[model samples]
Target: MHKRVTFDNKLLPYLLVSPQILVTLVFFFIPAGEAVVYSVFSQDAFGIEINFVGLDNFLFLLNDPHYLRSFGITVFYSVAVAVSALIPALILAVLADGVAKGATVYKTLLIWPYAVAPAVAGVLWVFMFNPAVGIVAQWLRAAGIDWNYKLDGDQAMALVIFAAAWKQISYNFLFFLAGLQAIPKSLIEAAAIDGAGPMRRFFTIILPLLSPTTFFLAVVNMVYAFFDTFGVIHAVTLGGPAGATNILVYKVFNDGFIGLDLGSSSAQSVILLLIVVVLTVVQFRYVERKVQY
Candidate 1:
């Protein structure tokens, strides 16, 4: 049975949580409220005049072909990043779990990439893939492949996806490794005694036990790909090569600051928030059913 401890001073509970509540109010709720208010109003780029234009901004976005294209691009990019990050991390975690010696050193080296800032990671990739002087670019040229991402839309999108996924792989590796380590050795030994091969034991037992961790990582990676990848894209592609890598979050910044379309940018933010909320709800509602714990 679970035991509950009651506080003698009821106000103490509220006081204990007050700091986090204040932070949420200051950072999240306040900005969200401002966005909702601004989204319904039209404002000049100079901010000299403002006029109420309820739903006009959202309507314009709904009808804009560029916005529609961006919506599709963002979905594809997010999926690619999540999949690419998760697969390699899982493989690395599995390999590291089997190491009998130097495991700590291997894990430490694998996790060090997570400490790198997203922009710095992007810059690192950019240097390696730079068309003029990059080592990888030179290798591609030697292989008779055109390696310029500056002018190629598809190449630019692929490059940003690689940069973003590379940054996230270390984060996923930590969780996957933890989950792998938590599984019981008895279960694997029992399966082996029952004539189960390594591959069969992994597929039937280990993978099933990892469902919960996999589900959690899926949600986190999706959110990260959607929102946290802005710095990487900014540093690397700047959402260019004909706007191929222009995801929603970056578009919000570009529209608001560079284009100076406050109303539209606010509306886009609201919409992006809604999309993430809905996706999270869907995952919790449906995807969680498959998780073991």
Candidate 2:
């Protein structure tokens, strides 16, 4: 039998929890409700007119080629950001875990990047890759390669992907380092005594033990790529160079805020919310099967 904590005063429990409940209702549910309402109604830029259009906003999005393109770009961008962030961070974490001298300093330096804001990270990269004055771009031009992200769609996409991934790497690194440290030293030593090499031991033991952390980070990284990188894209490219880097989140901003298509933007946002929900559910349902503890 499970024992439940009893509250002497009935009102006390509700009072204790009231603030959080009120905050959630006001910020989350209320905004979500407003977005849903706005999605079904067409509104002019000045908000002088808001006509109920039923599902027309959503239908327009379905028929819009730019919206379709943004959807595809979002998938690719999310995958690339997740993979790039996870793998390099894992490698750095593993190396840092094995470090004995200056370990604290090493980890501190690695974690510093996470403290930088996404917009700031974008600006930093933009300066480094600016075709006219950037050091990296100048070097590329010297080597006979065109390095103008402002003019080249592929280059613009690449720049944003790398910037976003770089920003997330420190976060993934922290989690991975913790996960690495949690593995039992005895298990690793036993594996070594059994004639397992470092690579073999990692693949056979460490990787399996780290699966749970890996799965959690994967879900978080996907969500980050979907929503949190908006600042990066906005600051760096503004989804420019022929909309090459216009992932779904940025597209919503571009359409709603920049293009002043309020109804269409709201529809896009609702769709994005649904996509995130579905992706999270799928991750828990299928991906969690691989998680080991």
User: Cα RMSD (Å) per model?
Assistant: 1.4, 1.7
Runs with alpha carbons beyond 4 Å of true place in candidate 2: 1-9
| Candidate 2 displacement at residue 233 in angstroms | 0.7
lDDT of 1 by residue, 1-293 (tens): 89997779979889999999999999999999999999999999988999999999999999999999999999999999999999999999999999999999999999999999889999999899999999999999999999999999899999999999987899999999999989999999999999999899989999899999999998898889899988898888999988899999999999999899999999999999899889988999998987897
User: What RMSD does model 1 have?
Assistant: 1.4
Say what the RMSD of model 2 is: 1.7
User: Which candidate leads in TM-score?
Assistant: 1
TM-score of each: 0.96, 0.95
Considering only N, C-alpha and C atoms within 3 Å, which residue pairs clash in candidate 2? none
Ten residues in sequence with the least summed lDDT for candidate 2:
283-292
lDDT of 2 by residue, 134-233 (tens): 9999999999998889989999989999999998999999999999999999999999999999999999999999999998899899999999999999
- For model 1, the superposed segments whose C-alpha errors exceed 4 Å read 1-4
